[model samples]
Structures are given as C-alpha cells and as structure tokens.
Target: MDLVGNLYLPEDFDANKKYKAIVGASPFPQVKEQVLGTYGPEMAKRGFVFLAFDYLGMGDSPALAGEFKQSRYMFRLIENTWDAVSYLGTLPYVEEIYGLGVCQGGSIIASAAVTDHRIKKLATVSGMMAADPFQWTDKDVAHQMIAAANISAQKIYETGEPDYVAPFGLNDDQSKEEFVSAAAYPAMAGESYDYYGRDGFRGPKAVENFSNMHIGDQAMQSLFSLCEHYADKIVQPTLVVYGQDAPTAICSTAFIDRLTNDPEVSAFGGFSHVDFYYKPEAVEKSADTVAAFFNK
Candidate 1:
C-alpha cells in the first residue's frame, strides 16, 4: 500500500539548495499526530525537512490485510519505510535521509536501517527490543499477558478470521481498570487521559477505533522476531533514548550491546514511557538529541 505522509519543509526551504531529511515513524496504534507531529515541526524549525506518516492499517494510511498473513504487516512496515526514503530521495533538494522512531516505530526503523542505506543516522525513543519486558521484571504478569495474547492469536488462526479485540478490553474488569488508570499522566491517574484516549494527543481517534487498535497476532510475533534478528545488523550511528522509570528501559542495554558501533544511550531519570510522548522536557530533550545526532 502507498502510505501517506506530511513533509515539514524548513522555514527557509529552497528547492535548489540541498538539505538533509528525516523520516519519522509513529508509535504503535498512533498516526502522525502523536510524537511524530510534535517532533516533525520541531525539527523543521531547526532547519531540516521531516516526514511523518501512518503505518499500514493505522492513522491515515491504507488498511492491512483483513486476515493475518503471518509476518506480512511487520515486513510491510520496513518496505513502506524504504518507500518513504525513496520518495524523499527523489526530491531535488534532499541530500541525506535519517530516521527516528519511538516505541514500536523505533524497532521498525532499526529493522529498516540495517539493510537500507538511505537511513544515514538512527534514533529510537523507548524502543521495545523484545516482546517480553526486557528481563523477568514482571515474569508472572508478563506470562499472563503473553498467554492471553497467544489465546487471542489461536482464536484468529482457528476461526480463519482476524480477531478484532480492543487493546483495552471489557472482558477483564480488573485488567481494564488498570489499563484505564495507566492511560493518564503519571500523577493524574484516573483523573486525566491526555496522551492516548478520548480528545488525546492522537487527535479524534480513540483507543476503541478499530483502525488504531486492531492487530493480527502473527503480526505481533513477527515484530518481536524482527527486532531480535536485526538488532545487531544496523551499522549506522545510533542514539538510544529511554526513561529510567519506564518498563521498556530494561531492554536498552540489550539493544545497545548488539549495535556494531558505539551507540549513544540517553536516560531520563524521572521520566516514564508516556513522558517521552508529550511531556515538554522529554520531547525537547529527545528532539534536540536527535537533531544534533543527525546534523553530525
């Protein structure tokens, strides 16, 4: 599918003057409105053209296959990214291209950068390197979640239909309650839902929006496998950012260890995973670091 994107040209953009470019991938279930929207313009203000787009089946992009095709969606992500790079390369003013991804996007960009030379520099914010939370931080809970996911996957395979399950389902009231509580700012808890719920940063779409929440189980499996398989193959300069307090932070070491070059890892001491998405400090810090790295 041909993915759609918004190109943020520099304020002083000139078609005849060559400039570097950055392709931003959004977080899971998020379109360009989330972090990419925030960072894309910010990078443009700093003098680089930035492109942010929705992945297949999410945001404004075309939908994925109605039925699960094993790792098809995961691989499509890499293909679509290269497509974005190729398109940007076609622009007369674009000289070099870079990549930045957050959460799932982080892993996807890494998967693409390994084999595609168009991405000259790479950066990941709160990137999830493994399906399970880094180590056994919450093994029992992780096991429960994994089992639940597998059961959902089995349902899809057996019925020969994609299981349309909500990311936060109503079947488990207790789990649903926790999921709801966790959707807010760290201190707002139950009282606020800013980052990714109704009227959230992701625009009109809510978590219940099928386009934002639907995912094939096989796609999940393939995503994890790709991250593991391509972790070390990326040879470009990489900047890894994570919150010291986020659960995904545990996997940063593993991701860095696999890099062939000396990867730069930045840790935000008091920030959480959600902070990197909209928190002013976290966002500025991440964007500045990324801009600096790419400018080098």
Candidate 2:
C-alpha cells in the first residue's frame, strides 16, 4: 500500500547494518510534512529512520469525504499509523521500532503501543489524558461536538458531500478573538499568526461539517476511554516529554505522570515538551534525552 506521508532514511542506512526506526505522528489538523519534516532529517542523521504522514482526511492523504464519523476516522488514522510502523519493521535495515507522537498523535501512539508488541519504545510530546479536551473549561463543547458529528454524518448520508468549516477559532483574518497563551493554543501550532509566512501551514478546518470535532470534552472522554481500556496493557519503555512554558505544559506533565504511574508502563521518563518541538536549546536537550532513551 502507498503510504500517505514522507519517510526519511538515515544517512548511514545500510541493509547489512540494521538500525532503529522512529515513527512520528503529527498532531490533529497538521500534515505529516510539517511536523515530521521539521525534525526527521535531524533524527535521521542520528541513525534513526523517521516516518511522518497525514491523517486520513487531512493533507495529501485520501480524504474520508463522507464515509465515517470523527470517532471512526480516528480509528482509521491509528490503523494507518500502525501500518506505517509495520512497513518500517519489515525493512531489512530496521533493527527495532519506536514511536513518538505530538498532541493527539501522542495519545494515538500510547494506544497503539499498548496493543502492538512490535513497538519497543514510546514517547509523547504534549500528550493529553483528560476526560475531555474542553473539560478544563466550563463550555458545553461536548454537546456541540456530538451534535455536529451527528449533523455532519446525516448531511453526508443525505448529500454524499462534505461541507468544511473552521474547526476552532475563526479564520485568521476573520476573527477578533485574542489568542491566549494556553496549552491548546500552542499545541495548535502556537497561534496562526506565526504560521502566516510558512509555505503550506494554514488555519484549522472541519471537513465534512465536522466543526465540533476537537471539542475538549469529547476529546477528553474519548482519550480516557482508551486509556482505561489500554493503559494497563502498555509494556513498552515510555517517555513523556512536555515544555514548562508551552501552553499545554501542565496538561502534558499531568499526562506523563499518569502514564508513569500506571502499572503497565515498565520504565518511563519525562522531558520538557516545548523544548523538543521549537526551541534550539530545548530541542537539543530533548534530542539527547530521546536518543539516550531509545539507544538504551
């Protein structure tokens, strides 16, 4: 099967010299090209093959048009991500396999790592473990998400077409809501303004009328459900990294603590999540931490 994202091979890769592979999963609303491409080559130089790809309905991947709901689509993306890992594992040059997820991707990786024995190490950057994405707020966003999912699913059932809209805040030029310094804010790429000049980065959108997709409440509930089911099964070496200054730093730290506290996790470590993603000193620290963890 043709993979949906880009894959980078280590510079010293050789069929005779087996090397470890690292799969990178981008956060929701982000293409693999953006997140994976950002650090893949650097990781490759460290002797790890990196894989990154878009989710089912985003970026260059096959758009789900109207076949499934958000919950279902989430499963498909997880499956696709596993497929990527399986494919990498099959390579003659691959000696071991590891996973790294950002934001929502982190949750996906955590779930997958529990069930897939091929994954030996796991890492999450700004991972969430809350019962709902919006549970931190007083908003009735969960109801909105369920309602929107139902409405969009019905629309697709009737019209066989999807109506896309802004997923979170209004489009950059159309919104006056001041962006706040919060976990969700930075996890959503640290403000749209910063991405304005980037070549392909753009604002978030709800495809197939999935406008209420990322409601905090629903996300939290779904993730906790997964954690409840699989947290006890995760046997891999785990590392949860978060940034103290990043918007979601506290949440990420809480998430990591929860995972480490779980009886299923064999060994685990924590890091500054933000430092790994954007800052130079932080990235270096994160890279060293990750390299050492994986190398062990």
Candidate 3:
C-alpha cells in the first residue's frame, strides 16, 4: 500500500539485522510536526526505527473539502494507520511492531489494535475512550454537538464555502469565557476546537467541509460504539499515560479503569493514565513504563 507523510528509519538499519519498531500517531488536526517530530527522533536514537504520518485530512495529505468527510476520515485514520504497520512489517529489520498514540490519536490506535492483530503492544498518551467527551452525560452537551453539526452542514449546503470559525475549543474570545477551555493548551493553542463551541483552529476548507458534511454524527457514533465493541478485544500488553494537570486526565483515568477492570483484558499490565501527557515527571515515568513494556 502507498504510505503518506514521513517514515524515519534508524541509522543502523540493515536487512541482515532485525530491530523492534515503533509507530507514532499524533492528535487530530495536529501534524506529525507537533508531537512525533519531537518524540520520534528521540525513540530512533534509542535504537528503534520510528514512523510518523499525517492523517488523510490534516497536514501534507490530500485536503478534506473535496474527497473526504469527517466520518470517513475517522475510518481512514484506522485504515491508514494499519497500512503503516503493514509497511513496517515488510522491512527487513523489523521484528516486532509497537503503537504509540497521543490524545485522539490514542483512541484511534486503540480502536485499530482491537481489530488488527498485527499490533503486538500498545501505549496511549492522554487517550479518551469514554462514551463521549467528558461532559456528554448532560443532555445540553449532546444537543450542542447535534446542533453544531446541523448548523455547519446547513451552512455548507447553502454556500460553496465554509465560514471557517476557529475549530472547537480555542475561539478568539476564549479569554472572555468563565473558565479556561481544554483547548487552551499551548500545543493546541493555534489548532484545536470544541465540537460544540467555536474556539479552536480550523482551516477555511475544513470549516466549509464540516458544515457541508454528515460525517460528524457518524464519527461520534463510531467513538461510542467502538468503546463497547473493541475494548474487550484489546489483549496486548498495554500502557496508558496522561497528565495530572491536563484537563482530560479524569476521562483518561476512567478509560484506563474500564480497560483494566475487565477479566478478559486485565491480564495486560496497566499504567496510571494521568501521568503520561504533559507533566514532566509523569512523561518520564510513562516513558520508562513504555520502554519496559515494549522491551518485554
């Protein structure tokens, strides 16, 4: 299969010798430059060949406005990710494949591993696997996504272009809100959004496609459905990392708890989901845990 974005092979790469491989996926709307660019090279220095790529709709890949919809993008993420793994396995030096996912990409990797047996081990940073976003239990929040989807879709249908408001969480007026939204993180300050509100980063084309597309509902529905369908099938050795100070720590912990509590799944060792994303100490600790798990 044709692979997209970048693939970095270790300096010692040789067909005669086999080495462990690590595959990294970034957060949504975030290109490989944001996280993987920093982490991949470091892991490569550790004697592991690292591979990172942009999702179909983000970064160097094809734009979403013309060929893809939000729902299809989610499915494509899984397919493309699996493609990366398949490509890695074909390398002469690759002996085993490990997955590393960040934020939304974390959940994507988890969902992929559930169905693809090629993934031997898993690690997630700030991963979300809840029924919905942290506040979804509230009817207001549920309706908010539905309403936004409807509004965006209508706008796209009426006009050929999208209005292109900020993505979701980091609106221009975010400072004016009563509380700091989760989208305020420095890494996401310029490229994030809340599905319900208008305070994030989005390109004009994304905005137009979002409004014109029906995939929003399909993506949300898949997220919820996958938690029930694949959570039990994730039997590989797993490590989950999150930041205590990070806004999504609670949700990450809840997800880890659900995965570790199941008898069919608990056999895999687990980590505290809150200590892996941004906390300095937590990041180091989680990295150690991941190194140990992958080495095993």
Candidate 4:
C-alpha cells in the first residue's frame, strides 16, 4: 500500500551534500499536517530532512484490503514506521536516519527503534509513552472500552463496514468550552480537546483528511501496546521532553524510568502537554532540543 508523506528539507538543502534525516510519527488520530507539520519544518530549518506521513487508513492513505479507514492498529503503525525508515534509505543524500515522535508517535518510534537499527536516535515531545495506565487506570472503564471494541470488531466482521467512534469523549459539534463545562472527560485526555475540538487552533476541519474518529475496534490493540515495558530493549540515544506540570508528564517520566540507557529529559515547568503541538515557544524549544540531540 502507498503511504502519503511530506519531506521537509533545509532552506539551504543541497543535493550534493549528505544530511541526516528524521522520520516523525504524529499524535493519536492526528494527520501528518497536525503536529508533524509544525515540527517537520522546524527540524528541517535546523538541518535535518524530516519526513512526516499518514499511516494506512488515515488522512490521504487508503486502508489495506479487508480493513476500513481510520484503523490505527498498534502493530501496523510500527510496520508503517519501518516502511518510512526504508523510504529514507532510498534518498541518496540521507545519512543516519533518526526518529522524532510526538505524543503517541513517541511510543511508536520507541517501539520501532527497539529492533530497527535504521533509526539511529530517538526523541519524543509530550509523549503518551505508557498508554496502559491511561486506559487501564479504572478497571470498570477498561472493561467498558474492551466491550465496546469487541462489539465493534464483531460488527465489522459481520457487516464489513467500519464503525467509527470519537476516541475522545467530545463530539465534533461540541466546543472545547462545552466539553470542559460539562466535565465530559475528567482524565488527562480532556486537555486534547483544546487542540482537536472544532474550536481548537487547528481542529479536524482545519487539517484536511483529519477526523477525530477512529475504527472502534482499534481500542483492542491500542490498549495493549505497553511501550515502557520494552524501553529497556531500545538502545538508541533517546530524548524525552514534556511539560513538567502537565498531567501527562508521567508518560515521559514512566518511559524514562524503564529506559536502560540514559535519556535526556526536558520537563519544562511552564509548558503543558498540548503546548508542544502549536505553541511557538514550546514547539521551538522542543524542536531545537531534539535537533541538537539528534545532531549531537
């Protein structure tokens, strides 16, 4: 299957000179234009060829046969990351390829780098590195998520039509204020509404081919990827950056805790989780740090 992507090259990019490359994995349910779009250019400006792409069934990429759109299966994303690394290998000017993952993408790159030596270095900004705690924190909620996924999986098997659901609680019609007012999502995921909601700085409508919904069955596989568990296996030089005050800060901390190799941690006090998405200061800080780390 063909995967759609955008490659950001430095303004001074020369065909004759070899340059290091970075493959960026984006946040959950987010297209390449969302977080990656913001960082890809920044990294390129800092002297690396940055590649950002939509996984199968996301954005402009079509789903594989027997699969429906918005199917973000955990394992499939890793395979897609590998394919992206392979793509970088085809570029004559690329030297050592690196991986820069934001939010869920961080976990993805780390998982891929576990054995894929192609990715020489790794960096994650406000990463949702350990997903199980967020999904399995409450036993009842966990069962409910599983039951919903089971039902959706069964329906797809029988009907061949994908059942889509907003992974986040808010509806497309709902504004972030409304969601916050009603206390729709009390968990850390609620912070996401500020970015994914219709009123967000860059909502689904703002980014082409983006929707807040994903195949309902994705939860089954999504909840099972314990990236922190495999952190010890990842030997690449890694950098973990996030907002120290953000509730999701634990994700980076937890991930770093399990990393056998010493990782550079940048938990800034003023920034929040979503701040790294579009906030210029946060993005620049994170991007510059990542570029420096990869370059080092």
lDDT of 3 by residue, 245-278 (tens): 5566655666666674332111112333323433
Candidate 4 local lDDT, 69-112, one digit each (tens): 88888898999999999999999999899999998998899999
RMSD of 4: 1.6
Ranking by TM-score: 4, 1, 2, 3
Cα displacement (angstroms), candidate 3, residue 185, comes to 11
Backbone clashes under 3 angstroms, per model: 0, 15, 16, 0
Q: Could you list the CA RMSD of all candidates, in the order they appear?
A: 4.3, 5.6, 6.5, 1.6
Candidate 1 structure lDDT: 0.71
User: Over the stretch 103-200, how does candidate 1's per-residue lDDT look in tens digits?
Assistant: 77887888889899889998988887544445345677556656767887888778877665445331212232465655534443322244654455
The candidate scoring highest on TM-score is 4
Query: lDDT of each structure?
Result: 0.71, 0.59, 0.59, 0.87
After superposing candidate 3, which stretches have Cα over 4 Å from the reference? 1-3, 68-72, 131-135, 157-163, 171-225, 260-282
User: Which lDDT value does model 2 have at 35?
Assistant: 52
> How close to the true structure is residue 27 of candidate 4, measured as C-alpha lDDT?
86
Candidate 4 least-lDDT 10 residues: 184-193
Q: Tell me, by lDDT, which candidate is best.
A: 4
Report the lDDT tens digits of candidate 2 across residue range 122-142: 877666533243243545665
Give lDDT for model 3: 0.59
Candidate 4: give the clashing pairs: none
The model with the greater TM-score, 1 or 4, is 4
